[model samples]
Target chain A: MNDYRITTYEPRHRGAVVEFQQMLWQGGAAGNSAYLDWKFGANPYLDDRYVTLAWQESELVGMLGVFGSCWEVDGHGRVMLPCLADTVVAPAHRGGPLFGRMLEWLVERLRADEVPWLLDFGDQPAGPAMLMSGWTAVGPWPVAVAEREVLGSGEGEWSAREAVRGSRSGATITPVATSLPEMPALAAETRSRGSVRVVRDEEYFRWRSRNPLARYFHLVAEEQGTVGYLIAHRTAVDTDDGPTPTTIVECEALDDDVWRDLVEAAVATLPGKVVTMWVRDLAPAREQSLASLGLSPTRPSGRLSQDIHLPKLVMRSTGVVDDAGPLATLTSPDVWDMRGVSGRGWR
Target chain B: MSGSHDVQDVARTVLDCLRNKLFLDGVTADTHLIESGLIDSVGFIRMFVVLEEEFGIEVTARDLSLERFQNVGSISRFVIEKLAEGGGSDKPAEAVRA
Candidate 1:
């Protein structure tokens, strides 16, 4: 612990950046410079404010990403906390102190800016680490996703095969059964929306555009060369099929059947089964492009972070302390008594 | 009969306006608007302001949550329901208002 000092890549340490990312990802599949390019490219939207690296003398021991800003949220309201992610500690340095040290440093940085909250997806093992560092888990967004592509034919082995194919690198992306009668209209509508498209280098595009843990496919519609639409590869349907390969539709500004085209494109690319996307509550139209598909009234689930003492935001469910059990007895006769750690999605 | 539907409408309108004005996406019934990664605590207060601006609804700190407005369906339901109930409660609309 005494041996390490934290640093950032603001000045652009190409070699160090590559090294840090290599260490952070830690696998041949770590997806190097191409990955960094994507992460940086996404900075405009992701806000990519904090990417602090921990160095023990000359060795990069860990890194943390802190993205904080204000954004309008659909269902909840205006959100202004920093999103914390990409926390990776070198396996050799995984003792109790490093995580806390990184967070303390982060808290200092955020506090300096007067930012209120911090949010993240936690690895269960890191629970105690955050608690020791002063992060109380208020709750988690209720939804999560996974990625896969189907191929070969209508809803059959081919579809499943395609899902596998779509996930692998260099695999051809084919649209699976997106040829719906409504596709033309869907594509037109997606095109009409005119959302700024997300552009990334291929590897970075695939990795940055996906759910970090899930690695699902993220497709967006592009106009000319600028991107304008996006499609998440996770689809939620009436049934909970096992290990389902889903593409969720996160954003799109096109007018044409954006849903139909992306879905169709997926169906075609996969070369099998019905390619589908998971959307929260009820919706989509496509044909233009997946990523360019319009946003539904539905909000994708994820947690928000905030300074505990904000004027209006108060903790009623009791996650402030490190208690795993529900602090208060719930009186909801209708809902089940859900109790767990503070970050439990049901809290 | 009227309570649930009214809350749902206001919730939908709020969600729609946020997406339109603020560039938010992936909203749904079970989506925890407040807790979701979308907003921070301060952002939460601004949401109330937006609601007021867009729907003419006055929300307070106490009027927040599932017990009152659980989902978008319930949120809209709660807003309209509570509004219909005539805003006479002493409790604040915490979820919607700061």
Candidate 2:
């Protein structure tokens, strides 16, 4: 008999989500409150694509959510991960193979869907699972800050045509800071992998994009009110590198050439030499867009971490297939889904 | 021939910097930088920049470990002393990765 079983939630059971949260965080009100806000608050952006819970002989062993999101680069944007904001293992079930199993289960789900995401589960539980799977790793995209302001403060942002304005004459790009309302409809049009769930909509949009720690920006190109390519700025973070204005290109349809031009246009508004913006990998278009602008990605050896306390709360063992239909197969979308990833914020 | 910042003082400073800046909403100096919700791998590059800029030192991509930047306090202490030594980054590739 299977002593341990895992269940991946459809949509998200906020009640179940909260209960699991309370159980995992035994540190009382302060710790629990902080944990909840961090996972599901304006201050923190939680992805709802893959949320799961584990059980060991009727005990709620662990639960976690694999939050999928879209990121911006110079080119196209697609779904990726930002938070692995899941709590694993009840304190009583501390030392067992539950942790590895939970992680394996998550990986199998991700692999099945063929979706790529950044693990944000406090760096502890994720270390082992990533190692076991040997996934190709990327960044601690340096979080830097410019003399910044709160996001959505109605600031006068750099215009998209600021690209052409800063560059050669007759540049055809325009940067638009979209109203919070547009995210959902645009997100609904997004393409994604398998049966993965997304938490896109207006309310989440306003909350996720408007947080103090989060920074978002977008680029759009139009020839005659007919738009072509667009990109998103992920969350803004403060670091000793000063501060960085970051963007995750959530989705893009422009061919590589147009994407490259757009990147050149975008980089003009940045703090020169300081490297305030850290655009993550998105469309293949960004492959050269960043390079053309004299910008380069920092290279580093893989960073690793391991869970000390909540091992069982991490992830599950793989090969246990989901009972769903074709939607269950985990293959990434050919086109990036924007709202599903905070909508057009990144692309 | 020690400089203005002592080995321990360097540690303290690094800890202080992390707490003052990168600490997420619920994070503090005592919180483990890696194990906490403060950062991810891509975020580490920025961590490096912060260490260099604020501490007036250099942390090469080669000088990385979960131990070095494990906690706010540990990262500070390590960087301060490393700075006193000219901030030279000549650690062997093996040691940095390990």
Compare the candidates by TM-score and give the number of the best one.
Answer: 2
lDDT of 2 by residue, A1-347 (tens): 23788877543444445566655444345554444444444232444445667876655667765554434322223334444654566766544555656766777777676544434424353343343343322233322123323333224554432544323323366666663344355555544432343455565565555533334555655444323344445333333233334444343433455555555654544322243333333444454355556455442322221112111112222333343533223332322222233222321
Best by lDDT: 2
After best superposition, candidate 1 residue A72: deviation in angstroms?
0.7
Every model: Cα RMSD to truth: 18.1, 13.2
Expressed as tens digits, the lDDT of each residue in B17-85 for candidate 2 is 565665545656678765553665435555665666666566642355567777766776677667767
Per-residue C-alpha lDDT of model 1 across residues A273-329, encoded as one tens digit per residue = 333333221233331133332322222111121112211111112133223322221
Candidate 2 CAPRI grade? incorrect
lDDT of 1 by residue, B29-67 (tens): 677654455543344445545654555455543344434
Looking at model 1, give its docking quality level: incorrect
The 10 consecutive residues of candidate 2 chain A with the worst lDDT sum are A305-314
